[model samples]
Target chain A: MDGWLVDLVAKYNYWIYVVLMMIGFYAMIRKNNLVKKLIGMNIFQTAIILFFISTGAKKGGRIPIVDYEQALAGAVQAADIVNPLPHVLMLTAIVVSVSVTGVALATMLKIYKEYGSIDEDQILERVKNHEP
Target chain B: MNHNLPILVLTFPLLAAFAVNLLGKISKKHVAPWTLASLVLSSVASFFVLIDVLENGTFKYTVGGWLPPYGIELVLDPLSALMLVLVSWVALIATFSALPSIKKEMPGREHLFFSLYLILICGMMGLVITGDAFNLYVLLEITSITTYGLIAMGRGRAPLSSFNYIIMGTVGACFYLLGVGYLYLITGTLNMGDIARLLPPLYESPTVATAFCFLMVGLWIKMAFFPLHGWLPNAYTHAPAGASVLIAPLMTKVTVYLMIRIIFSVFSPQYAFLIHGRVQTLIVWAAVIAIVAASLIALSQRDLVKMLTYVVIAEVAYMVGGVWLGNTNGLTGAVFHIVNDALMTLCFFLVSSAILYRFGSTHFKDLHQLFRKMPITLCVLVVGALSVVGVPPTCGFFSKWYLLLGGIEAGHYGFVGALIFSSLVNAVIFFRVLEIAFSSAGEESVPAEISGSRETHPLMIPSLVVVAIALVVIGINAGSFLSQVIRVAVPSL
Candidate 1:
């Protein structure tokens, strides 16, 4: 039963990542609304963040802090070792992703001001006739 | 000089960007000089790095004195260093040349333009050097955001184009992050070298396959590969002429570099070849479609800049198809073309912008008699156009020779056919424009009142002269240049 649950959780995690990614991609592709596209972009980036953070977690590993350096001076155990590299990397990725999203939103705002609409199709149609 | 030149390639422009943003309001003259100086500094730094890499060997730098796999790492292999030098050289030339043009096009936004320009250079430098997967993401964002800002700063319809670029660039970056996340899940590492080592045993895992697919999709979008290139022509056309000159040469090429890195540095070629066979085939077909579709599309465009933008779409496929051929020759051809195509693109865009500055015209109809009025610039354009069409005695010809050699070597005759078709289409497309340029009435009379009023801005002329010299130098010395720089870089892949 425990093995089955472990398999199920692993399967569930992969499924969730795929589903969220597909939905984000679908929204990005199908939605004519620019703001909605940005929202989709955010959702897409956040799902990846969740995927990375989840990967760093172990079955029963404690928080990644190894407070007792002296206790492990004589001998180290595998159970106490935690993978913190991915966590740190994920932190940086999250920051970068959010900043790009912020910039994209700002660009969308500017687009709205110029075209008076945020719909992609409408903007394209108008831009065709609007000579610079 | 310290063998730590990679830092300067990125740092000098970045610091100047910050300083310019801070000082632009205080002194209007400061921005151009400061941006020029920093780009020159970056160019010299990259040149030194390339020389060292050629004479000695690849050098690695770890940020904060942390070793690889633990802290961030920067690598200076020959290919990347060559690309770095190429990027900075064109950027410096373009910025100096575009200054006067910027004065005319973007009157109040000079400071913002220069700052974003530096940020763009820094982002490309960072992307080229960093060996950490996550760090690449950060730098990619830095480049993407700056690019959006640079494009948004253009005149009419610029903001709309920038918005489209933002939407596409965001999706690309997000897909990359998702790919990285999947790799992290299976391997528990973000360092590319470490991931590469760990991935061999996990080759059959669906997680690994998914990661690879996600990565390829993300890079394709970033590189503006065909069918996925919806945002590019508008972005290139609508951006400031200076921005177009700087970006049209480098951005997509760097994304191609990243694609090479991920395929070879993060996954062994053997596993990739075996497990991703169908994906490679898909990319090759996509390249064919891009070449055909983009060329046909370019033929119909009346606007010169937009037409050139579509031509870039086709050029990108030439490299993409060459790379996807999956032979050593193909990879080498693709890699060689990256440099050749970049130089050619820079040359073309420089001449195009010069014409734009002179006549306030990029439409084919208004550009009648352009060849007669802009003699020197037209000569440069002819040379660049011939190079773009892959004529003999230019860098473009040799690269296409290799790409064709690669196609034949790999038994991909269809790709060979596509290459020939594309080249013919390229020749026809540009020569058709050339005919328009030369055959039009030789009316040198620019309405003396208008000519007297504009004065053509003093700085703009010298900028063209500098880029013209560079185009000739790159075209002439491509053989030795490739051997010295790109050859060393390809092995790391």
Candidate 2:
């Protein structure tokens, strides 16, 4: 039990991401307001981003920068440097999440103008009633 | 120049999208010409790329001269090459019809609409050709974001539908990203080829299996596969006629293409089919339900566009089920259906656009004596409907034949039953529409202003005629096409 606990604690980052993702997923599906749904989407994306970033971290590694003289000599040690690919990939993901948030907010603004409410139920009712 | 054909197919539209936006501000007249010219160039390049791929076999082009496993690469095999030609030509043909429809529907917004249209094309083209797993996600988001914008541009409840699509699309894309992240964590590589190479030894690992599940679920959501298809119908139905002609035909089809790519390219057939044997049967059953349910729902729709949206969902199930059947014939059917389905869906939507342009609505009541009023458009509609019903000498029949053959070969009788049931339901639904259209019962009820026998815009009918002819041509030549293209496209099992 003690060893199991240690192993669990060691991989707590994965656990945290899973929890965060579920929370976001639940809100995205269950939330009534469009804004709240968009917020849930943001949280969901951030969880994935966190997961990607965590994959790049090493216990005793430095940043992915290399010494010029060491790199030219072809003696750069891979283990000493953190994996930079995931971080680079996450940077792109962050940009995508931001763009998505931007588009979602714009659509929400239009929805409010058209339906006069951002709540899902109210909007649905208006749609059903054919109310302008 | 010959070797650069792959990247040229992508860059032409990507560059033109921005050029069109900027040029539109200078003069509205420039938008159509610029958009058409770029699409023409892209289509020509894509055709040449297909020829190149057919001649030389599969090849990869590294972005910026950086090799794979580090830099991005675009891989053009027989499969993606064929898809590129399909997407480029569909967008070109659709644009011919879209111009006049946009002028009628949203006059001043043509430039913005075409801009998004061009970017969406680039994104889909990129999605088809990119070999990097992460690159596919970025392209997928690009396609989704542009689609969200295009769908929102429609009138009445479109924004709400677009919002719903945005939420669902983001979840799907993020799930895909998470799956890729998991794979990267396990294999320390993001290139699909690299990951596939590393995956076999780790096939027994729980993480690999979990990643596969996440990836499949993500793609299923994107493709609107049955249970995850909530966003597609409303979104496509509410979209403007101009946009629906493009998005309805291509978006789900491209995502299905991605699913096949992942199954065959990122994970081998042995891993996807043999190792995950139980899941394969379960997915095929799920597909059966998707087809039946979508067909039934389509039968109940009052509006033409809404019914066709449900039909699109059912066609998606056909392709998904075909692939999950775990045999070469099934995969071939799925790939061929992607091509057939895209063209047929485009044909149907283009007809809808003409109808919407003529009468301002496609409700059944409004469509009374449509055959008499718009004979040319209605003729093309019959051709499309016939194709959808799996009538012979049309493209749809050939693909459905392959799918039925596949189902029988795999001994998945449920799938075969569902395909036949859906086809029968489709025939009934279409014949019902035709009966209403052919009858003169409600002729007096149509508005006097729309009572003429005039066809749609000259541009519109020609494009529709071209597509309708292509459907027949493709059907007649399915034998040669199957040998030359799809046979090569289907990975040897």
Candidate 3:
């Protein structure tokens, strides 16, 4: 039991990330409304962005930028700073996520205009009742 | 300067997209020439890169002058170089043919359409050439967003269908990003070669296993592998003919190429097979079902475009199953099929778009005696159909032959049976269409006499003829591709 608790605490961030991802995944697959689906997609993207950000964290590490005096004296230690690669990647991921959401919203507006409602079932029924 | 050719091949399209969009304000006529010139020039650049690869294998560079594990890398080997050239040529031809459809379907959206078209090309080329996993996600989004824009431009039900596509595509891309996050956590690197080296020790770990599942499933959804193929038919069917002709063939093939890259490049086949032996078996079984199920669904379809989309799904199953068979023959078949299927599907979709243009709808009932009216288009259709049915003297037979041999060598007889069954099913589907087209026009119920003019856009006949000739040419020369390129490129497990 103690070993189990220690293991859970050691990898707690991953556990939380998985739970968050499952929430977003569920909404994406199960949501009835198209806007809800778009929201789910954003949530899903955010979960991934957060996961990348989590990978950059290190205990007791400072900002990744090199200190001038420490660098000048050749005293900077690799472990003294957190890994910044994931952070840089996450920044890009955030930008991509924003772009996707913007496009998805625009697409949703088009759907709403076409169907007069964003509910998936309603739209499907309407399409069946009418001709493409 | 020549060493920078890989990045140059990719950057030119991205810049051209911007240039075309801006130039549209000056003169709308410049859009087509600008788009074609860019793709043609990039194809030239990519060909130089391919020649360079044949001379000195595997051109690799670090972007922005940073080292591996730190900067994004650009790579062009035989496989990616081949894909680069094939995609450029297909898109160029598709753009040339799109002239008629663009004016008819959505008149005012040409500039926007051409801009997104160029961007989509950039995304696919970048996806193939980029060596970093995160960079792949960004490129994937670029492809997805531009695709959604172009898909929404169709006349009827297109907006709704593209909306459905946006939801599914974003989910797929995010899942891939999540998988990349997991790898970065464990390997501390984003460069594919660097991660492939670091992943061996962790192959047995649950984390790596989960990551592999995410990546495969993500790509499967994007490629619309049979079960996850819900978004494909509607999206492709409703999209403008121009967009369908361009994206239908390349999008799924490029995604499948990415899957092969992940399985054989990033994970190393030994580790992937070790971890996914059972999963790969399951996937092969799933693929068999996909082959039979999609073919059956296709037979029941009245919409020619949607029927071909189903065929696309089954063809994807062929490539996916062949690669996972874990043999050199299977991998070769899979890679070869990507090129063959892309061209054949492009040709077919091109034919369908021409039909839509001439007749104003894709319903099979509407097109009778089409052989008499549009001989060139019908001939192009026949050539493409023969290939899809796996007939000899066409490219499709050779790839399916390799796939069958690989399946037999792997002792997967069920998959072998599936392949044969699908070929027969495809034969039935295409032959039925032929009979409908060729049967006496007197007996048919509807003549579709409204738009009976034989003068299809002057450009259409030339493009179709070119693709048809290329089909037979590729079939004749497939032996060279197999011996010279594919044999050397399949990475050893």
Candidate 4:
């Protein structure tokens, strides 16, 4: 049982990515409101952020750095090295995703103001009216 | 900075978006000229990069002086350079066309519109040039976000159309990011070159196959290929004329470029070719379905803009099918069509927008006998329509010719049938519009028609001229010059 728990935790990162992805996708597709959909998009993008960040996580490893004691003793090696590159990339991706979400939300607000409602169904109705 | 021009191509327009925003408060008059200047500068930068790549072979410039396999890299290969030129040239012409239509449609938001437009161009250019897979995601978001804004800027149903686009675009991007995550997990790299190097050894791995499927599906959605094209028609039809002209031409084609990059650069053709023949056959049949279904749907649409939107779906399938044919001729036709279709669609959108501006609506039934009032715009539409329908003198013919040759070479006579069917459908669709243009509606006095036409700003003429010249130039030189560039690009894939 103890070993089983450890195995689950070992793959904890991927499990979180999968759950978050499902939640985000459900929110985007199942919700009818526009702001809710935008929020869903945000959640969806953040799941990706989580995935990238978690991929950089290492088991029982310290931050990648030069330590004199470890080097002199020859105690440290590749096994304990943590990757910082994906963390940096995730930082950029997070920023970009947030910026895109902000723009999308702002556009949604504008859509609401122009149409007087934010419901997708109502907007579609009004659009049909406009066409005819 | 000369060797670094690809990065600068992205940076200049981003900076210009901000500059346009801050300066629009001082005076909105400079928005058009400022946008034009920014696009021209980008065009010049792309030209230099193209020349460098063609002359010196593939040049990879890593961001911040970091070498590839470790740091981010920007690749200036023949394919990217060709796409860069196509994107910037369309952008420049679209900017010119957008100016006049924008003034009439969203006079209050010209600055914001043009700013987003330039930023959209920058995102596409960046997406094409960057050799980093993760970087493409960032750039894709930039383009997708700006696109939502541009679509929202249209009147009436614009907000709804834009909202639908946002939902679909986000899902598409997230799907792509998920695929990127899968790739990173297996290969432990985000750079295309590094991924390419790592993937060869892992070609048969199930994880790699999953990643490939995920990426292809994501990109197919983004490109609006067949089944995934749900959000495109409304978005294109409801967008403002200016936004329609700018985006309809290049956005999906850039996504197609990304698909090519993922297929060729990240996963070498050797590995992809090794995939079971059954998979290739499945994809080819899917493309055929897209071609036939989209054309049939297009035939039923009454709105000209909406009809054109469906036709785009069909056209995308043509390229997708051609590429998946998995032969020299197929790949060449697909890549060449990428350029040809970009020009052809831009021409069509420009003329369509011109019609919208002059007539106040794009309804097929409403456009009776209005051709005499705006002869120039009508004539432009004629040429654009002819090109779109794959007429002999237009560039569309050559791409279709090559695609047909590709189909025959691949022994997929059904694909050739689909191609011919789509061309015929396109001909029927456009000719219906032309017939309407010539028909005599009840004599409404010329003054009212002129008043309706008065909404057009001077920029329309110049934008049409740019698109018209591009249509003819690309059509004529497609055989010798452009085909050669596509040829160079194809061998690398």
Number of the top-ranking candidate, with TM-score as the measure? 2
lDDT of 4 at B161: 77
* lDDT tens digits by residue: candidate 3, B271-298: 7665567977898999999999999999
Candidate 1 achieves a global lDDT of 0.81
lDDT against true structure, model 3:
0.86
lDDT of 1 by residue, B62-158 (tens): 8879897878898777767777877888788788667877877888778888888899998998898889987898888888888988888886788
- Candidate 2 per-residue lDDT, tens place, B1-493, comes to 3778889889988889998899887888998888899899999989988888888899899999999899999999999999999999999999999899888889877889989999999999999999999999999999999999999999998989999899999999988988898898899898999999999999999999989998999999999999999999989988989999999999999999999999889999899889989999999999999999999999999889999999999999999999999997888899999999999999999999999888888888788888988899989989999999999999999999999999999999999999999999999999998998998764356543552456778889889999999999999999999999889887777
**Decoy 1 TM-score against native:** 0.93
RMSD to native for every prediction? 3.0, 1.5, 1.9, 2.8
Question: Between candidates 1 and 3, which one is better according to DockQ?
Answer: 3
Pick the winner on lDDT between candidates 1 and 3. Answer: 3
TM-score of 3: 0.96
Docking class of 4: medium
Q: Candidate 4 at residue B471, lDDT?
A: 74
Range of the 10 consecutive residues with the lowest summed lDDT in candidate 4 chain B: B445-454
Candidate 2 falls in which docking quality class?
high
Quality of candidate 2 docking, DockQ: 0.91
lDDT scores in order: 0.81, 0.92, 0.86, 0.82
Look at candidate 4 and tell me the lDDT of residue B183: 91
Best by lDDT: 2
